[model samples]
Target chain A: MRNILAIIERELRAYFTSPIAYVVLTIFVFLSGLFFRSILAQVLQMGLMSQLQAQQLGPRAMDMPGMITRGFLSTMSVILLFVMPMLTMGLFSEEKKRGTIELLLTAPLTDLQVVLGKFFAGVTFFIILLLTTWIPTGMLYLYSTPASGPILTAYLGLLLYGLALTAIGLFISTLTENQIIAAVLSFGTIMVLWLVDVLANNAESSTSKAVLTYLSILSHLDDFMKGVLSTSHIIFYMSLMLVALFLTYRSIDSLRWRG
Target chain B: MITVENLTKRYATKTAIESVSFQVEKGEILGFLGPNGAGKTTTMRIVVGFMPASDGTVRVDGFDVFENPLDVRRRIGYLPENPPLYPEMTVAGYLRFVAKIKGVPKEKIGAEVKRVMERVSITDVQERIIAKLSKGYKQRVGLAQALIGDPPVMILDEPTIGLDPKQIHEVRELIKGLAGNHTVVLSTHILPEVEQTCNRVVIIDRGKIVAIDTPQNLRFQLQGAERVFMEIQGPVPEITSKLKAMPGVIDVHTVGSNDGRHRFQIEGELKKDIRSDLARTVVQSGWGLYELQSASMSLEDIFLKLTTAEERE
Candidate 1:
């Protein structure tokens, strides 16, 4: 446990001391802010038009807070797909390129300790990124009344989703020593997982469609967006994270032999 | 103490090392001498538990490297060919990190880093970023990292490869100072480094150890013939024939002739001191002996002869 903390401290310092952290934070916050404004504008205009229609016909129900929060949270999830690779590209790849992996491996620590330490570093940065979304969401609280339940659940969903993505990126980082290759390959892999949902919708057979939907990385995320806390969805995300981490552990073990 | 037997590493494309074995007694410095691509780095890496050997057993302090890796690693301080340094970190921060990972006591981390920094003479540059430091400084930082926990065994691969002559001298001196307390296995292709620093040398060629002995013993074993030179004023053919006739003198030839002085190159039996005999004979034969000098084989000659002679076979 102490070894893991030591590695995490080193990894976090490595992230924050370089330009990569600042650049990534700035880009993510700026883009999320832009998408938030656009989504808020669209939500307000639709709500006003619906209110006018209700006056002409009969009273109708439209949950403005839920609609806007869900829209904004969904956009944040998509934005994460683009930003996660940058955060994890250097986790193991940089270590290998600089030959610091030898130092870590030859130290009095196990491979799992090194892998977990790096994984948590990426997750910590992602959490910091997730906190930036609260700024726009916090603005919603001051101007209008929004349900706290859905907002909390939405944040929970984003956290789990981001954890899964980070684990995937960490595994890919172990595959190569070049950060550029690691980043591009992680992006490609996540893209395929994201597209699997679309593939599931077009499948003609029920069994094939069911398996494809279950395998899609985003399929488990929809329930959390709807403010539904289901054990099945939580298990999906947790299992995905564990599987990726396990693969990373095995990869490091093989690297020791292959070296 | 470290003992390695039949350590072999075979990559998919080719074998890096084959049947290489050696032992280092406690408080002895063993120099691994080999040219480039001769598996010097591979052997050290396996011994330090950086990688496992394909077909051998390595016991460091009685713990098998493959079986009890953490036990072996905790006792070893390894410096790879390139210093494992993070470019963004300051020298002080990097040393602190190494000390932490190497498992120095929490209270002693600060003192340990300071001791190693002072030992390597890098206290002045402790705050400088590793990337910006000069190559010599970076190499010293690498050495400092290895000395962090003061492990009983240190495995350094080509530690003085890129330094200037003065820095090389300092590093060699520092390594020599580490003897009698820390067991060291340092690899180098430079001949004099082994002769100057190591207690024993294991000469490797083409992924195999060709010779293993002390520097002086290796020279004597590989160089079968002894040579001597003398300048004399006499008939050149007479001197050559007379020198050749002496007991244990293998060959004699007149190399050059100057103003009434002839220089003769003479070869004699191994382990024989023929210089005094030649000098006495020259003065007795009514010849003016201007100079008499013995030319023994240097380590360079033995290295080349051992490496190339195997290639021809």
Candidate 2:
């Protein structure tokens, strides 16, 4: 456990010492705040129009805070795909490029400790970036009553989503020594998974659509955004994270033999 | 103590190191002497658990590397050729991280880092970023890294490379000082380095060990044909012919003539020292023997003979 923490601490320091962390954080914050403001404007305008229609008709109902929260969070999830790769591309690739893998491998620590340390470090950074969205979300609670329970579940879902993305990036990072290649490969891989969701919507065959949608990471997030937390969606993200981490463990072991 | 038996590592296209085996006794420094691409790094990596040998077993401190790697790793400190440093990190931070992972007790980690930094004489630059340090300082930082946790065994791959001459001397002294407490295995293509620092030398060539013994013994053993150099104040042809006539003399070649003094290098048969015989013959022949001395084979010649002589066959 101490070994794991040591790696985690070093990894965090590496992030903060370099410019990648600050650049990714700045871009993420700017984009998420922009999305949140636009979504809040759209919701408020729709709310105003609904109130006008309620006077003309009998009455109608709309959960403006839920709409705004769900819209803002769903947009933030797509933004995560763009930035999570930057967080994880250097996790192992930088080690290999600089030949620091020798230190980690020859140290008394196990391969799992190294992988777990990197994994949690990436997840921790993702959480830090993900938590920034709460600033915009906090406005809702201060001005009006927003359902806290669904917002908590939404954040949990996004955390798991980030974990799954981080796992994908972590495993890919181990396969290459070039950080740029690792980043591009991870981006390409996650984008493929993202596009699978769009393809599922256009599928002619019901069977093919079900399979693609089931495999889509974005499909699983829709339920969490809707405040409908299902066991299957949680299981999907958890299992993806687990399988990718298992691959990372195996890749690290294979690297020693290859060398 | 470390025992490596028939360690072999084969890459996809080539065999890196083949059937290489050596042992390091407690408190002994073994020099892995080899030229470039000679697999010295490959073997040291295996010894430190950095990589697996395709075909052999290595037992470190009685723990089989395959069966109990962590047990062996915790007892071994490794300094790879590249130093394995994070360039952005401070020297102190890097060592502290290494100490933590090497399983130093939490309470003693701070002290251990300080001790190792001081041991390698990098205490003054502990707070400096590694990438900004000089090459000599970087090499010392690498040494300081391997000294972390005070592991009983140390495997250093070309520890002194890229350092200035003075830094090389300092590192050699540091490594020599490490002997008798830490069993050290250092690889180098530098011959005098082995002579100066190591207790035993394993001369590897082309991924195979050509010789293994103490420095003096290797010199004596490979010096089978004794060579004697003499500068005789006489006719060059006469001195060469007269030296060739001596019994047990294998070969005679006159180096040069300066001021009517002839310089001759005479090769004698195995286990024969014809310096006395050649000197007596010169004195009796009414010629002045200005200088006469035996030239022991240098490690450089032995290395060249062992590494390159095989291809001639």
Candidate 3:
């Protein structure tokens, strides 16, 4: 455990000392802000008050705080697909390129510790970047009453999405010494999963389409975004996280024997 | 203490090392000498547990390398040919990270890093980024990282490969100062470095051990008999015949003639001092002995003969 934390501390310090973390955070915040403003404009132009009045909804009909938070969550999730690869590209690839992987491999720490430490470090940084988006989301409370449940659920969904993608990125990073290749592969893999739902919708059988949709990370994330805490969605995200991490560990293990 | 027996490593169809074996006692400095691509690095990597041997048993301090890798790793410190370093990390930061992974206690990590930095004379550059440091300083930092955790054994692969003459001397001195405490296995293509630093030498060639002995012993074993090189102003035939008839002389051959002066290489039996005898015989024969010096086989000759002979076979 101590060794794991030591690796994590080194990784965290590396991320904080480099400019990549700040650049990622700035981009994430800017995109979140842009999406928030566009969502607010569409909500206001829809004049939701009349729709709620005709449906005998309360005076809180104009309160589209849930929709605003959902918009931020969806945009952040998409943004994460880009930012995660950038964050994890150097985790193992740069270490291999710089020959520092030998230093780590020869150390007393197990391969699992190195993989977990790096994975958690990337997750921590992603969470920190995600938190920066919440500041703008929190401002919604000042203008109108907002339900905290949906906001909290959306945050949970974003966190899971980030964790799953970061794991995939780390796995890709372990596959090569070239950071550019790692980044591109990681982004490409995440994009395929992100769009799997669109392809699944055209399946001939409903059951097959449902199975494919369930396998898509974005499909599971939709549950959390809508304030539905489904056990299956939680299991889906956790299973993907587990499989990605396991594959990463195996890749690093093979490197030790083959490198 | 380290022992390697019948180690073999094959990469695809190319064999890196084959049936190579050697042992190092406590506090012994073994120099691994070979030309480039002679499997010195491959053998060192196997001993250091960086790469597994295709077929062999390596025991470090009585722990089998493959069976108890963590134990072997804990007791061994390795510095590869290239100093593995993160370019963006500061010297201090990098050392501390190495210490952490090397299993140094948190409280002692700072002191350990400081001590290694001072030992390698990189204390002043601790705050500087590794990428910006000069090659010599980077090598020192590399050495410093290996020295962390104060392991009992150190495997340095061409520790001074890229240093200037002055830096090489400095690193040699530093390594010399580590004698009697650290069991060092240093591999290099530089023959003199083996003579200067190692108490024993292991000559490897084409993935095999050609010879393993002390520097002096290797030279002495390869030298057949005490010979002398002499230049004389005499007829080549007369000098050769006269030198051959001497009591102590075994054979004399005219090696070369420069400006009417004949240079003859004379070989004789061991324990024979033929320099004075040859000079007298040349003088008495009415030939001026311009130069008469004993020819000693250097370590370079022994290394070349061993490695090149293996190539022929």
Evaluated on chain B only, what are the TM-scores of all the candidate structures, in order? 0.90, 0.93, 0.93
DockQ, 0 to 1 scale, candidate 2: 0.84
lDDT by residue for model 3 over B1-313, one digit each (tens)? 9999999998877998999989999998999999999999888888878778889999999999888988999998889888999888999999998998898999999999999999999999999999999999999999999999999999999999999999999999988888799999999999899999999999998899999999988888777567899999978887888789989778889888999898889988776777888888888889988998887778998888888885576
Clash-forming residue pairs, model 1 = none
Model 1 agreement with the true structure over B1-313: per-residue lDDT tens digits: 9999999999889999999999999999999998999999999999989888889999999999999999999999999999999999999999999988888989999999999999999999999999999999999999999999999999999999899999999999999999999999999999999999999999998889999999989988765678888999999888888889999899998899899998888988988888889988999999999998888889998898888987687
**Model 1 residue A203 lDDT score:** 99
lDDT of 1 at A76: 90
Clashing pairs in 2: none
* lDDT (tens digit, per residue) of candidate 2 on B195-273: 9999999999888999999998998888867888888897777778877888999889988888988788888886887
Docking class of 1: medium
Scored by TM-score, the top model is 2
lDDT of 2 by residue, A1-259 (tens): 9999999899999999999989999999999989998998899999999899999996887888989999999999999989999999999999999999999999998889999999999998999999899899998989999888778889989999999999999999999999999999999999998899899999999999999999998889998988888999999999999999999999999999998
lDDT of 1 by residue, A19-96 (tens): 899999999999999999899899889988998998899878887878888999998998899999999999999999
Q: Which stretches of candidate 3 lie above 4 Å from their native place?
A: A48-63, A205-208, B225-227, B232-254, B266-290
Cα miss at B65, model 3 (Å)?
1.7
